[model samples]
Target: MNRRNLLLCATALAGSFAAAPLALAQDAPIRLVVPYAPGGPIDATARALAERVRESLGVVVIDNKPGAGGNIGADVVAKAAPDGLTIGISATATHAVNPWLYSRMPYDAAKDFVGITQMVRVPNVVVVNAARAEQLNIHSLADLIAYAKANPAKLNYGSGGNGSAGHLAGEMFKQRAGIYALHIPYRGASPAQLALLAGEVDFNIDNLAAAAPNIRAGKLKALAVTSLEPSPMLPGVPALSSLYKGFSVDTWWGLVAPHGTPKAVVAKLNKAFTDALKTPETKTRFAALLAEPVPTTPEQFDAFMASERAKYQQVVRASGAKVD
Candidate 1:
């Protein structure tokens, strides 16, 4: 062959080798792991985002890995290949609080994953069964605190599970109010809410989105929101911070990839998520759940995670909430 032809042939082969991996990577399906069971707020949020994400990236799958207080699903994603294709949707309880709450975690919250972006934040609402609230005359947080002080260990509160956001919020309330109420931990929020409705428990600190409808229907009476500011969904309800300074416990959800993922891939995923949050449909959906869509850069998200971890660590220590 002529020298010129040989050079062109060699150049073409090199280009193909370089482009092959990029093509394959683009075609691969991205797996988004939800570390909780289906039908919950996190799962619903994941599914909503996934639909929009698919528009940006062709194929995406949401795999539910529920167990062990979300450790099982989180660990699976944490240990997966850091090729950007495998990501996990995690909550404040899993990423921020788990390290301090669990005796021995299978994975390190900071070291095991890279934060892509924060999705949303939902306030935790303090609610009680309407009938029970009327009987106890616990129309507000002040009423509950007064009652608890008067009758120690008589008021029983339920939570999603041990070491969950609801449980921690209740503990924080106890600490701030200086009351002694019995804690009843259930498998998840649904069961705990059920327990409260069945008159098995006095009250619960649950996600505002989950409790808002019940509150509006008069099934549950919202006493207060665990946020510094009042929730739009419950405008009449007061914030816990109003009664006790700095009292707040809002649950947040975010997306993270396995540690060591390429920076370019993380940036791409962040862009997709940020773009998804910008869509009117997504914003409306998140709003419906009393969740605010918060699109942030990866570096910003990392810093936020660090701060949240520190905050929750203190709460865990204060509450002495731990799981073996």
Candidate 2:
């Protein structure tokens, strides 16, 4: 062969060799880690995306790592090999609030992971026990505030955990409304909701999904949702922002991979998941959970995380919330 032809042949062969491994890698099953127990909003949303991702990516598995207020599961993804095969579902609590809520966090939210995309933003609802509401004559946000001012520490509020989004939302409500209520933290939303239902706690700011059935069944009384607008599921309920101007607190879920994951892989994951959000079935599911589907590019997700981190830092300082 001529010298020029020889050079071209060699270049083609090297390119083929380099491309072979990547082709194989693309076919591997991607692992998506959910940093909470099954049945929670994060897990449900992750599984929904995973199903669609499997159709787009060929194979995907959802792995639930539920402990340490979601930090344990998040750390596993943070430390995993950044080969693009391992990804995680993280919420505002894990990425934005935990750093400020805990004196020491296991991983740096910004540095330890590269954001893929935000999947959904779920609003929380302020729910009171029907019995408690009737007994205390707490019929609305104004009534609740009046009761709190009158009762002082007599009224208590429950949350999912010390550093969870619900806890922060409750604290924000306390600070914004200038009310005094005892804060009770539980392992997760189930126990906290149970406490409110059983009258162990007077009220709680809880995920709308967990509180929906109770509210519909008349077991729990929903006064106002924590979002800027009223939730479609509970249209009769008012928004907290209506009571306290500019008041809004929401729990959101996003996808992330360990830092240094291949750019192509991250792009692929983002495309697959974002596309999944556009599907009619996915939209309906999100609506049922009172979670709005929020699909964003990686850059947008990163910017969102930064803003959330700053916002939560201010909230933590203002509320004086900390994890021991």
Candidate 3:
């Protein structure tokens, strides 16, 4: 055979060998653990990602084991075999906020897992029931603050249980705005959103992906997003940072494997999901949730996780959010 032909065959073989693990991942079915219950944003993202990632990762299976505000499911992934098969979909709640909010954590956020790739970032937004907004004349963050200050304890904000991002954002808003409002915690975002729709609560700071439908349907009115900059999904909506300089809060989700997983496996998994994130289909599906696909390298994701935990530690401490 010609030298060129020989080299071509060798190159093809090497490429196939490199992709062997991806094929193995499919055959073995990578256990994609969503630390929260099914039907939530994280779970939905996992399911969507699984369909596309399967083209690379093989048949991915979502396993939901929600408890202790994501700690229970996270711990399960942390202790799983370091074989890269048991990867978890972690969020700000599991990796960043829980360490500071919960009195006793089931697993160490930074130490127990290896960062894979950040999947998506869901902007948190402050929404008031449309009727309540008109009744209180709260059209903007500033207006809400003024009304809240004027009527302390009369207005209430709901959250997806204590220590959730919604709760922390509310507390941070209170601290930054220097306003007082009662906090009512619910079992989950659905209930909190329902409470707002039912007029049980005046407002809520919730994930835009979850609240965007309601806002578009006119069931709720979005005042601002809890991000440093504006979100395209919520056009014309002011960023909370615009109102409270330096104020920013966004809930992000990522993939993580049990620590000690082979670096090659980590690299394969990262490529699979990051590649999935680039697809137009995934982008369209994620848009439905009002989430933006954010793909990052393992090292970058690790650094990002550190910054998130550090930022939320103070918020949780200041809010005095306890999940004991």
Candidate 4:
């Protein structure tokens, strides 16, 4: 675990901060570790929920730790003492996909962390730089396929990192389209979006929330949403399944404490977060980000995780993605 773990003094936190008034920020704040860079979908969600959770839980802080496809930060939480003070805001990539993709994982996704509650689910969109899309005359998924088929390796895509949901989606796209494209992996989703903005890659399948501002600003053109149905956030963007049947890939964010965290503590944390999600301000903010709040109980979240992990296990195996 990182030396920063010692700074939180997590075990002593309840005694020091729990009794403090909620209005007055506590001396020892709960650290909400985010395994991705700032400005991405997960970061935005974490910061938003952190404010609301603080009101009920005393004080909460967001800690960004991006690397190894989110395992670095997740491992930090996994290894931390099972105090409620240390928890991580994780995504599908971190909790479900990484376990199957990496040969030697830093932590066990299912066993190392106790599920608190899922915060929200954000659909992903296939997008290209507006200028490039215009130049290439790619107006939709069909156009993208035609272009890629005509130009083989000329087409390229960017992803958050190897074994990330974005990476798997890109591979699925190529496999279904019968086209070849080079893969460019970045440290985080926001960095991948930056590369797309600079035209570093031809396209990217990015979370709609992270790409919404740019797409609305015309910096990027959303061609298709990676869901069974079209995204309500981007109603005009067609669903990828329209082009290739049964296509789906949506990313989500949620909270989890280290394994052995008391069930009572987990329930308390879940209540705080779910209460935050029900707030009007938080709801409006999450809508603006194009994420739907989905607060779930620990048992429900555990089952959801199992189903998602099983679904992505097949995806990773079929994609032949290896993070050895």
Candidate 5:
């Protein structure tokens, strides 16, 4: 063969080799592991993002591994290869509070995953059954507090369970507000909210999305929000933080990959997801679900999760909430 032809062939072979990895990455579908059951807000949001990011990341798939308070699904991502093919949803329960609440964890919440970006925040509303509130003559949070103080150990709140976010928020509220209200644990958030609706429990810090209908129907009177600011979904309702400075506890979930994933891959994932989050379509859809989209850089997400872990560590311990 001529020297020039030989050089051309060699260069082509090298180019193909260089292109192999990129081709494989582009073709391989990213499996988004949602640490919750299908059909909930988390799963719904994951599906929405999956649809939007498909153009950028190729075909992204949703894998629900819900169990063990999200530890089971999170562990799947924790143990996956760090080649950026497997991404998981990290939430307040999975990443922040569960580490302290559970005696045994499948993986380190802070170390097993690298944040890509924070996706959304779902505020919890402090609500009372309207009939029960009227019966008790409690019209506002202050009125409830006064009632609690006047009738110590009489006021009780319901939660999904002992270690659930609702439980922790209630505990933190009790501690921060300096009130003593018994906590009534139920099977799930639905049941807990039902207890409140039926007047079995005096009040509940319920997920806004779940409580919105009741609140709108005047069955549940929203006293305040657990978010730092009043949620747009609940107009006129004050934020608990406004009353108790810096008090904030709400459901938040973000995208994350295996801990050792390359920085370049992480940045790429962050950009794709954050871009999708900024779209008007995503914002409107998330608003319908009563979730506020919060897009942040990977470093910012890491910092946010770290702060959440620290804060929940204190809150979890204070509540004496634990799981085996």
Candidate 6:
């Protein structure tokens, strides 16, 4: 072959070799880890996004690693090779609250991960057992606040755990309203909710999705929603912000990869997941779960997480909650 032709041939061959690994990477299954157990809103949302991104990103498998307030699973992601194959869930706890709440952290919340896209946000509702509310003459947020003020520590609230979102929200509520309520921490949100249903606790600032059924069934009286504005899911329920100047606490989670993942890979994953999050299917499914899809760029998600961490640092310190 001529020298020019030989040179072109060699270049083309090298180009094909370079493209082979990229193609193989696309075909490989991604391990999308959930930092919680299998059967919760976080898991469910992760699964939904996985299915939606399949056509673009290939098979995405879920790995549930639940323990130590999500640090165990998150640390798996943090310690995983940053090849984009081992992305995991990042929630308020994993990325924001856990750093301050835990005495020892498995991973640095801000340093160990790269944000892909924020998935969804589920507002919390302050709910009382229907019978308990009736017996206590608590019909609204004002009434509930008054009762708590008049009878200090007479009312009690149940949360998933000491440092879970529910517990932090309850603590913030108490601080804002200038009232005290005994906190009862259960194993998980389900158990805490069960405690509320059985009247074992007077009230709970619970996930709207989990509490919606009982609220509709007239078993739980939703006094207020923990959002800046009233949630459409709970139309009649006023926002706690209306009563307290700054009472907004809710559940949110998203996708993340180990820090040091290439910017190109992070962008690719972000585009795939954010596109899926914007779809009508995702919206409908999230609405059924009482969540709102929040698709944001990596920079935006990072900023959001930073603000959250700063906000929760104070909350956690004020609550004096810590895990050994």
**Residue-by-residue lDDT tens digits, candidate 4, 178-266:** 98889999987889999999999999998887788899899999999998888778878888899899888888878898898777678
lDDT of each: 0.87, 0.86, 0.89, 0.85, 0.92, 0.91
TM-score, model 1 to reference = 0.90
Ranking by TM-score: 5, 6, 2, 1, 3, 4
Q: Candidate 2, residue 231: CA error in Å?
A: 1.3
Per-model tally of clashing residue pairs: 0, 0, 2, 0, 0, 0
**lDDT at 116 for candidate 3?**
95
In the range 84-196, model 2's lDDT, one tens digit per residue, is: 78889878888988889888889999899998899998788999999889988889989999989987888889987776777788889988888888889998789999989
- For candidate 1, lDDT tens digit of each residue in 1-324? 999999999999998765543343357888899999898878998899989988677687899999888899999989998777789987797889989988899999989989999999899999999999899888888998999989887988999887888898988899889898888999888899999889999999999888878888899999999988988778789999999998879989899989987777787889888999989999899887778998999888888888889999988898887788
In candidate 2, which residue ranges exceed 4 Å CA deviation? 1-25
Put down candidate 5 lDDT per residue, 225-282, tens digits, no spaces.
9999888788889999988998888889999999988777787889899999999999
TM-score for each of the candidates:
0.90, 0.90, 0.89, 0.81, 0.93, 0.92
lDDT of 6 by residue, 1-324 (tens): 999999999999998765543454478999999988898889999999999999988999999999888899999999998777889999999999999998889799999998999998889999999998899889999999999889886889999998888999999998888999999999889999999999899999999999999999999999999988899888889999998877779789988999888777788889999999999999999898899999999989999999999999999999999987
In model 6, which regions exceed 4 Å deviation?
1-25
RMSD of each: 3.0, 2.4, 5.3, 8.3, 2.9, 2.6
215 in model 4: Cα distance from truth in Å? 1.8
Choose 1 or 4, whichever is better by TM-score: 1
Q: Tell me how far the alpha carbon of residue 150 in candidate 5 is from the true structure, in angstroms, after superposition.
A: 0.5
Q: How high is the lDDT of residue 49 in model 3? A: 88
Cα lDDT over the full model 4: 0.85
